[model samples]
Target: MSEQQKGPAGGGPGGQRPGGPAPGNFGFGPGRGGPGAMGMPVQKAKDFKGTLRRLTGYLRPYRFSLLIVILTAVLSTVFSIVGPKIMGKATTKLFEGLMGKIKGTPGAKIDFHYIWEILAVLGILYIISALFSYIQQYVMAGVAQKTVYGLRKDVNEKLARLPLKFFDSRTHGEILSRAVNDVDNISGTLQQSLTQIITSVVTLIGVVVMMLTISPLMTLISIVTLPLSFVAIKMIAKRSQLYFKGQQKALGELNGHVEEMYTGHNIVKAFGHERKSVDKFNSVNEELYQSGWRAQFVSGMIMPIMGFIGNIGYVLVSVAGGILVLHKTITIGDVQAFISYSRQFTMPITQTAQIANILQSTVASAERIFELLDEKEEVPEAATPIAVVQKESEAVPGKAIKARGDVSFNHVQFRYKEDTSLIEDMDIHVHSGQTIAIVGPTGAGKTTLINLLMRFYEINNGSITIDGVGITQLKRGDLRNLFGMVLQDTWLFNGTIRDNIAYGRTGATEEEVVAAARAAYADHFIRTLPEGYDTVLNEEASNISQGQKQLLTIARAILANPTILILDEATSSVDTRTEIHIQRAMNELMQGRTSFVIAHRLSTIRDADLILVMNHGTVIEQGTHEELLAAGGFYADLYESQFSSRKRQVDAV
Candidate 1:
């Protein structure tokens, strides 16, 4: 990594802080404090269509259902208008029938029948509207679920293809939030928003049409208030979008903190920094709280305010209609229908306010999810990649394993994301079954060599070849499987002991798992555990000791039994007795495989076939232990310091 990256963003395994949006993170920005009350204003909110258009691609497969849902909502709204109109007709005819019946006038005998027919029509309209609503909701929910399923699947597949550098650059919390929380928010919104938005729109249009049919003059009077509502809605939408974006970003930050604390709880407790940790958590939690309140407060005002404005329109319609009646300019039925039409305007306006709040949240979540999927992935392959080996047998276990353990670095010079090389003009070769120890003072490119060999980072110059092929020519996944690595840091998944051991060769039998455990000297401790081989190691193997965790990792590699192994100071963290046992296990595992050991303990690598003493980027000394001791170079001095220290400790004992 670059020097800039080395300190912040993400540290490393144990120190990896995970990911959250930064404090000023309303939108993805170069700098951090986004707004407080305002949602994180997207960098380019006006250009959100591109993201929206892309998100709509997930729903493309459900286009037919989408159409059906929309049409049903519109049809339901249109049919709903028929209900109120029918009721008005029944009321008008019943009143006229009373006057005619009192005088025994003509058409009075049939007026009662007409009223019943009108009432029946209203009942039919109500039933049809309810049925359409049911179909629309059911179909919309199904479409939403299917769309979310497709979206989740695509995001997962894309994430899997991203290079290790991507993870190196971002925190685990950010990625986790995108996978679970962000995707979940989107799914919930889609389930109902698609129908609700359509229903609200169709109902508004239907109401406007019915109001015009009753009287255009009264409709105009009611709709003048429409302009004021529109302005209010747009203003609120802009403000709410900012806060909702802040809420989501805050939640992402909070998630990152929780992930870090949970993973490093032991470290915090051991360091006696409980108060410090709690204070940090509270600060993040408070930011989340503030963002949620601001977003909710802005969105919550829309519904009630729209209702108030719509009510004013309703009152105006009633007053105007009473005047028209006094002047004998319109019938009582016209006045009654106009009042009902005024109600139509008010109800839809209220619904619009409710739908707008939901729509803002949906947009915010969609924006965040799209941002992740669009992250630049490293190591993209050809549309039709060349396959060096394609045999089905190559994928199978024992038959698939190889012994071509030769690894050579020819004039290899590397730098981690910089021009100055960490390992310059370095040439090394490991023949099959050779035990090569790479020793150096601190900051002498020890880890960098292994990283280059593992292809975790690319060399700026020179070639690294394994088994007569340039490492770049090989598929990364296939190449890594050939080498078993045991690092000082043990990262075990939450699964059965057998599951963790057989993770590489997933189809390996239970017997293979136990055999590998026994070889690594891990079986004794594992058997003593509550469930033994069936035991689950939750979150970094919390239930086990550090020594046992390292042992289990060794057992995992032992089961794979690669032709080459990297024992990266695997025994560094254990006690003397445990280290000895681990060393013994390492010897057994490395017997027929090429191995590279990076160790701080000078005693451990003394018996290695070749010991290359490194200083800065160059190998200062190279030979057997006796050969180095005779030369009286850097290794001799390092050995003398440890050797004298051990003598003093033994004397004290």
Candidate 2:
């Protein structure tokens, strides 16, 4: 690939991680920079209200659940308030009753009936508080899970719609992290944190009201620390967001490293690059360690600080309330009630202050997930793409659509990126049943040509047509449905052999799948497996060989029975015996179909009716194998270089 195609920074040899630069990147894991890789900012919380408002839409479908959760929170808070009030009232009644009893008089003469009535009311409040709290916790959990489920589905669908280039630009792990860890953080913390907020506010309100009723002067002095605690809480939250964001980024990096290592471990072993990879990994691991410590350190400070302020509030209320009791500003029971109210009010404040970090981090996570969902797909079809229906006679086994299989590249031009053209001003035509071979060196646009033909990438400045009708005019899926491709990277999903063979023809009978496998010479090894056709093979189709894998892919294509077939580097990764078997299978599969072969194996395509030699985005030579050799052009030169080099090596041996 050219530098222009690669860009200044991309997935070449030196593409950095998502946020860039590991901790020790120079001759080690990172460079002069320490563990601050994501460059996280501790800015004041951005328009959190706006973010909260956006989140409410996720609750629309589960409005009833949301309603129940809200009601529970309110009810739970009311119970919390009643608990302290009940104790205070009963304490007062007990004190008065004791005084009457001490005078050797009937406790009822002092209207103990009123005190008993108040005590009964307190007992009733306690039951209500416990019941509401239990139900409220259950409902909020359901609400959070429901929101997260919908969000996950939305994110997944968005991922499917995005073009292949997006996957190339980002790591698999980063995308997976965005879907999982980030979403989990957003949802898991939401229910608890939101409930805490409600409880805190309610308790504060109830306590303040009760305290004022008893002694307003004492109440005012008690709440002096409340505002300061809130300010400190807010400051800690601001700091916590940076830490959480960094921590999340570090996790993504760690996951990405694991995925890369696992996927490419073979390459590491083969090239003896394991040591370098290990060193890089350890460096990333250590950086995560430091980042994690910092994030936890900041987030953990809120609770203790809020607790300290609550303690101060407690001391002030006690000193002031005692004085009020001594001076008869309030009765002993009233002083007791005021002290209970002060604790209630200050306690929730501390809890809310503690959970503030969880709330902010969730908001940040939601914003990130929304960002991905908001991405625009690269190739969107027209509102109504004209469809091409096939006749019953021409239709493939499972496909209902078919074209004439007559392909034409009309002044065709294509480029992986805009700066370089892989194919330009190319024109070619093939009948319904003809074979063409494309031969080229590395970087000769052979793969790009196939990509254009398959419509994986768009062509520029020209059009490709099937049966004189533009392919773009047809439905995208229908256009692709006419052909089958055997790519260099053969991806076999986790399933039984029969399922993989009949993957394209989903409703095909077992017999048809078996027939296709037999034609590809894959039946022998497949039947030898423990399960035969039912033998499961994701990556561990161990009883079979690489040749068998190639054959199986071919069998799948044959079962698909496409009118057009593309054999792109199909024989590139197998031994000589496997190549011969695959080549034979391919010839059988290609029969009576317009077939295109992209090959480095010149010998295989020697019988092709038309051979095109390509170089640097253009066809350098075109003719039959013999005709091209006689012309003595680029094709001839490539052929001579290959066979002659082989002959010289053999002679030396």
Candidate 3:
């Protein structure tokens, strides 16, 4: 039977036997920040100006629209600012009329006609102000959406071009938070905050000017609290900045925990480790809650504190304006105007203070988005690419050169980290149409060879060539097109079975897909499904059995029809009967091709052209299975232990 079909020592797929690793330690360890870790670390942008400048580059295309928005915002704020002064004129006229009537004066009657005229002007100004506000909001919305759309597109493209190492070193949830959460934060700031800044500044200047026109003494009194307001905001905002950073980091860690737990929920339940998973999640969740509330509480304090300072300024202005009126140095209308201006002036100050706190959080989010956009991409393609021409009949119309699958790795050296070598001084040669099997213990450099051959990771030293031409001379896309790979982990998207199979070759015919499935022994089960080839798989393809999924992947590789094939533990996760069928299918697929097979089951590769036994990052033995057995080296020992153990089991059965 395939090793995956049986748990260790003939147990079920749940691995419920006594000696299996605990579920909590399935794929995590102390080094991975196990359950007790605090939170995910955040990457803060060191160069804020550089990041902002690059972000604005995306906004360059909408400069004319932004200019219109600015003009409309100024117009609206100016109209709104002047309305109070006009209303103050009407108040003064009414007050004079009242005083004249009380004294029984003939020409002191209230100017009702003039009062109506002032009211009409005030209404007109308000209507114009509202109209401009609407126009500015409408225009700015389009600008913000377009700018963020461009940013999102750039980020998505950058993800496709990043190196494999970048993904290997980070979790999926961490990357997703940057893509989704951080980007949305930037969008909100752009849509709302930018125009608010323009309006607040303009209103503040206009209110101060109007206040001065009535009485400079009252205006001076109103602004005495300005310095105090600034001091409070500065102190509070510095502390708020730290909390905002913590909140963002905690959110990322929480997301990572959720993603990992849900993905492995089945194993957690099977092994009765639900409590452990929940406890780990609670630790991360508690951290997030603490940071989130602290950030909100600090930011929330700004508005009320600014309002208190503004109220103090209002009381002082009111008392001073009344004394000036009593002295007959200013009209009642002027005092009323001064008080109205005082309130208007302070409103904008409160708004600006609130915006400052929001701006800090926005900068934190933008820094994250910029960090992702600035990640290192894959190595550049060669200036001149060498094309692969596999068969004489398949030659291009004008290209004279041809490529065959004769691979050679000469003295290749590689290490994941600088201090630890994974492979060193490795040399191998495979003639065209040869099947080379790789055998090794766990942690040996089995898959590392495939990574180098595919150029997923460049070797530290030495050269790997195909058809006597170095792979580095060819474009990555052109080189990858020459081989098809099927790993142990099957990846099937949420789509119809037919679509998944056709993913191998673009625009493949229905007949070709069916033929490939039939050869891989997957056609029988596909037909038995309710929708046959039209069956739509769920997310993660959980609707199908593991063995069935492996068959479908094999069918896909067959349809690709590459000149070289790579199968890494391909048949390890199936039943014994299914493994036999898969072996027969693989033999057919590997015909007339240079194939590399990495397998743990020694019996499966007994007929291979060559077997390479690897240990400690170097090949210790190399020969045919029978020749290695006769020599009694490392390969012989591995083969004897596995087969002898299996023989005893069969005899007992």
Candidate 4:
């Protein structure tokens, strides 16, 4: 019989004229670089270097902590680096003692005490290294968490400030991915990868220095193998990167499909689309499997190829050191240390390569976050806004102004886009406590009128006034507080029934909440539930029936006690009996408050003081129900058609 629509309203249909876009078509367009293109899209940062520079701003506050982490990482690497060379001394000592014993030299017995001393020094060095590593890790974790905390806070605040239009064109899932997953990526990198990079670089440098001290020729041989390692990594990475991109794109598509199917499963079942949904899922899944498999296989080649090249260098170094030892050019201890340093050298290079890839991914995540933050925010509110305060009887001096129920729209014009005309030269005036009912066909600008009154979308021209003061001059919060709205599509969050009702008014007393529920004819049914007022609704509020949910929303609006009431098919969900009871209660509630009732059922609004018949975002007729009937106009025909249909139905029965 009636329908209530809510959320961001846009300009007229097809950019023709007046009323803006239809209500509740919060669509998801391929935004910016969103993946609707033909290829497997790689999720790379649009501005990698610029994003990194911007990312440093988040870390700037933790600069001192980062500096300490760097110093400790260096210390940890230095201590760990010195251990191999020192242990080589013990190795050389043991080797020399064995050689001396075989040669029958005097004092040829192994020096166990000297070896023990070297082991003790080595143990102390390792313990200190571990301690420094632990300290750096602990400090870095705090810095990382705190940095992300600030980032998440900024994102949350930004979401609040964003206009309804921003949400209208985007999916909830896409926005959430940027907010949750992307931020988590940045946090992980800051916590672990950042410190690892520092340690790896320091170790790489220390190993190079140590190797040079041992044998320049061996170091040269080891260094020469690095080019081969680079070549292998570059080739594998280049090939695997495409597959990685494909894998990511497939994964994203799979996730989006799952989210859609799960949320709309009831609709899918109603339409017997289960097989089709499964087929779609399987197709995406197979694509993901192929790409993921190829990516992993190609990426897996890097380590083995690098290892093979490294072994070749190791063999070359070993042979060169052996010849040098025969000539007494370098001690065997130096050869042992050099070998250890060489292994150490390759590890850091490998680690640095891995971290480089991670850094790219992290910067991409940061860029997504920055893109969200950079979106245009809602227009700024009026400066020196008029306060909507309580009005005293007899015009008390120095008291603030209070809003009366009078509302007037003077020659208003609006469009969702500048090129189209949705609402053109629309004018209406309502006195205090008048019950105005809007009757119209679909896309008739019925909801748009309510939206403009609520200031959900700003009008392009003319002015709307309440109590002789411009609505734009009033604080948005204050202006909105003047009206109470109840829609056909009821919304309730996961909370106790009492809490949901009390949401209409902050700090409301328990008695007031119960009284409002009673007025809405919801108290009796609510008390029958297991937990009564304390009953918790699920996320979708599917635990309760539709009519009961509508009743709860009605109760909420009643509790708000706003100056003006806007009921858009508020009683559409209830049964005939419940609707009668609610209508009686609403009559009592609207006694002195201005009310705007939008409905398609002509019979329900017969007693309204004023009825506006609308079509295509413009008012076609305006009069009381009886006045319109006597005039034999558009409203008269609409009213006659409803009764005629009902009469025919009764005759058929």
Candidate 5:
């Protein structure tokens, strides 16, 4: 891969986790970098209203559950809000009784019964409030998961439908960041922030109403300081935002540097670049520390400063309430209740401020997800597919019986970009049961030809056909099922060897899997492993040698039993001895089947029925090996060059 294709060292910024203080410590439920996270950089969507509306559509299916969540949240906050006022009545009764008793009045006795009843009522109210809160959380949790489940499912389906160019144009990390990290951001916001926003707003309004009923003058005094809290938050957030962005960027750089260094540590050590690598790591690490701490410090000032301002308001409300009590305008109980309301007032105000930032980031994440979901999918599949017959008499089971591997590309024109042509007026016709070899240098559009053949890309003009039926007339799945491919790079998932091989065919019996392995000369290696066919391949299949992995992929292709075989440098990774054995096995597999062999080693295609020498995406010469050499053309020159290179190697040995 080129440096451009590998992308940056730290993956991408969206994929990195925070490298400093845990976001949860700031009262954010998770490191969502969204609501209630003060220092985290806010990310606003380009189309905030549109993205938010689309995000809301995900919740449409759970409208009933959301209704329940909203009702429960409102009920819970209202119950809790009314508690402080009702308890104040008990306080007033106690105060009046004490004053009477001090004067030695006969009837002046503390009302223990009334006080006890008040306590019981308060406990029940709290219990009901707790129950409603629990119900809200439960219902919202379900709604959040189901909503995201649908969104994730849509993203997954979109990925499969996307053309190869879509993946080629972006880094793997970038795609994964949008699909996984961005989707997770939306999920976290839906699960926690959505409900919290509702409750905070409700609590703020309810607290004000209750406070007003106690003492309007005190309520006014308490709320007058609210703007100070907002101002402090705005000032702090504005200053800290830059550092938070720096912290995120620096963290991504550090992560990418570390990952790149670790993955290529062997090369680094061999080249004695350890010191340089360490110096680079230290540089990025230092940047992360600088930005992280600065963001934390600036954001940390918010709570203390908000508290200081809140304390001033508290002092003012207390003095005002005391004067009112003395003037007999309000009871002592009203003073106590009003003070509680004042304290409660500041919490939601702070929460509201924090949540505003969070919603912006959350909307940004949603916009990214929506962009992916809205990407144009592979040109829609054929609405009415032409059915192809399957015949057991075909050379291989499950082969394309109608075509017998007859393929023709008619005056095909293609270009990856509009400004440059890759393949122009390309034409090829392969007869059934013939071995056709495609020889070309690197970047000569060799792989691109195969990609076009399989419809991984669509041609700009002309058509590809199988047995006179246009390829586009069949469903993509049907078109691809006609051929089997073995490329230089082998791909195998983390699974038992048997399962990986069986992946080529649905419901393939264990007997057929072993037989296919034997045909590819892979059975000997399989039996040598500790668990044989049951041995599980680790991620990357690193437990096996490169040659063995290639053999396994060959076995998978053999099991597919396709009539049109594509061998793209299939034996490039094996030793000469192994290559000879594989060549013989492939020769037998290719009998009565059309095969397209792409190889740089001229010796491998010497026996090909028809050899096409390609250059600059156009075929320079085409003929049988003996006929091509007799013609003394481009094919002859390419073959002679490889032969002379091999003779030199032999002479040196």
Candidate 6:
């Protein structure tokens, strides 16, 4: 029967929107240095305490080791802090002895023996401090690495569970940035900044305690500079935070541009858009440069500003201590020690200020990583999954029923977005063994239909069934195992030809792989290669011809050997002679299987048992090829147009 239907549909050619942004857009609109274009949005953690708590959960497993690291950091800082005070004692002893000797008093010689003892003690303390510092670093390294290992593992697992819609909405580079750059930033902060924070706090506390013992007045002088130091830090850090966030966003955009342009270099050159591409790159690069230097310059100001504040404190303490020593209110040794503690005091404050600045960037990175981990995942599997059993031969009397390849779509409705209703009230059925060819114009929802069948995107309403069981009742993995697919865009990893073919069926034997290749008419050409079946495909499989890649994918599908087969323009890239051979091999493979073919070349499916004509998103006509041609409808017009176009091209040649 033939039918006609009308609906509102909006997808463009090849299931993409027509008149969409160009590839150079990179998901960021024009005005490269504009507010949003200058950088990616920084996602601040909603609850800093909660995020820190979650991050610390990863550290709980190694708490004992971390405790030892903390202890070592404390010991190292304490030992270093005590050294300056002890050295001051030796300084006072020498000064007293020199004054006595210059006055020519009896038994007034300098105490070389006491000085040697102090020097020996100071040397031992330095060595002990260094040893403890090394130990703290070693232990913290292991803890930091282990924590990030768990984080990276969780992110990867979360990626596998996420639905296809999540991927469709994001650029590949954005996802990769989260996985690589964001996680790495967390790792670096844990490894270095965590330890710095611990040491700075401990050193600050120990120096303050020692300084009080030497001269409380001198300590008060040192404390007066704190407000000025904090004010400078607060102002500079506030400004730098904005630039740092901008720097990260610009970096991600630049990375996205590089990845997209390099992957599609051939297309850009073919369209003579190289100059345009270069201009896009320059725009992004300039934004990155401006943000990066501003961030560095602002952060760089912190050290010097803190240093100036520290020197002001140092000179004040020194002058006050010197006056007190002259009045005999404090020993020269005490004054010397107070000056050393004053210097030590400001060092930790400066370091702590810098650490605060570093943490801003670190938190921004962690937020990005957490965002990816929190994406909505695919629908959960059935609580009670049904098994799919495919029967190869006559069924045994007591065995489970076999999957017969009968499929049905009942009142299905779907849309990519809320505004676009692409499919509505669609109904279809196929017998156990039938060849159904689907024909449609560009953007007619051809690929969308295949996506629903495979459950890549769930239908908004209705149900699809395999045999007599609804697909939702079956585990997605089990449902997918029942079908074999070959698409127009071939996907091959960076591996040998043999490895690519064997990927169809896990643990497939070498002989089986070879047989599959031969059946697809790919074995002869593979043998002619320099490395035969061992020839390696580069990234994107560019080392091989497009026809060869298509053939290899067919071989992969043949090896899968499912009860149902789906081929979407599978042979569109091959030559006429190669197409003939592929058609013969596919015919053999489709002997007893249910086959669904989608083709733009109407000639390819003339022999199909059923031909489906679709427009917009509805199935308008269904019948044998001859029956549709006699009806003089949409199918007839489509067939005639393609036929005439091909004839004109051939005649011209």
Task: Find the candidate with the highest TM-score and give its number.
Answer: 5
Model 1 per-residue lDDT tens digits across residues 47-98 = 4577678778888888899889988888888898766656777776776777
Residue-level lDDT of model 6, residues 135-211, one tens digit each, is 99999999999999999999999987887677677666567767766677678778888998999999999999998
Model 4: worst 10 consecutive residues (lDDT sum)? 17-26
* lDDT by residue for model 2 (1-653), tens: 00111211234322333443312221122122122211233222366777667777887887887677778778877766766656666676777667778887753345567777876787777678778888888888887888888889999889767755576667754676577756766675666677778778877787788777778888888878778877886677577556656655666677678778887888889999999888888987888777678766775676677678877877887788778767877777777777677767767765654455455656666776777887867477656676554523455665544566898888998766779666779888878878889998898887777667756666777888887778777766666667787766565656888887887566889788889999988999887888888888855444466778889889988888887888777888899888889988998998988888888878778899899898888887888999999998898888899899889999999
lDDT of 5 by residue, 378-398 (tens): 889888765653424443455
Native-to-model Cα distance after best TM-score fit, residue 11 in candidate 6, in Å: 20
Clashing pairs in 3: none
Show where candidate 4 strays beyond 4 Å.
1-42, 267-287, 388-397, 641-653
Candidate 3: global Cα-lDDT? 0.78
Which regions in candidate 1 have their CA more than 4 angstroms from the true location? 1-46, 98-112, 227-301, 325-341, 344-376, 380-402, 418-420, 441-443, 615-621, 632-634, 637-653
Against the true structure, what is each candidate's TM-score?
Answer: 0.81, 0.81, 0.82, 0.87, 0.92, 0.84
- Give per-candidate clash totals: 6, 7, 0, 13, 3, 1
Off by over 4 Å in 2: 1-54, 60-68, 102-120, 126-150, 227-305, 350-356, 385-402, 415-422, 538-544
Q: Per-residue lDDT of 1-653 in model 4, one digit per residue for the tens?
A: 01112242422112112111111101232111111111222346789999999999999999999999999999999999999899989988898899999999998988889999999999999999999999999999999999999999999999877766676677665677677767876887788789989999999989999998888889999999998888887777788768867776776678778878998999999999999999999999999899878877777777778779988988999999999989999888888888888888888887776666667767888898999999988667788875554423233455567656898989899887889888888889999999999998888899888888877778899999987778888776777777777777677777999998898888899999999999888899999999999999997789998878878877887888888888888677789977887787677667788899999788899999899898877888898988999999888888889899999999999
Give lDDT tens digits, candidate 3, residues 378-472.
77777776664444435466673455689999999999899998888889998999999999998678877877887777889999998888889
Model 4, backbone clash pairs (residues 3+ apart or across chains), number: 13
Instruction: List candidate 6 segments past 4 Å from native.
Output: 1-43, 61-63, 110-113, 116-124, 231-301, 388-401, 417-420, 648-653
Whole-model lDDT values for every prediction: 0.73, 0.72, 0.78, 0.80, 0.81, 0.79
Query: Whose lDDT is higher: candidate 3's or candidate 6's?
Result: 6
Model 3: how far residue 45 lies from native, Å: 4.1
Better of 2 and 5 by TM-score: 5
Query: Candidate 2, which ten residues in sequence have the lowest lDDT sum?
Result: 1-10
lDDT winner between candidates 1 and 5: 5
What residue runs in model 5 are displaced by over 4 Å at the alpha carbon?
Answer: 1-31, 34-36, 388-403
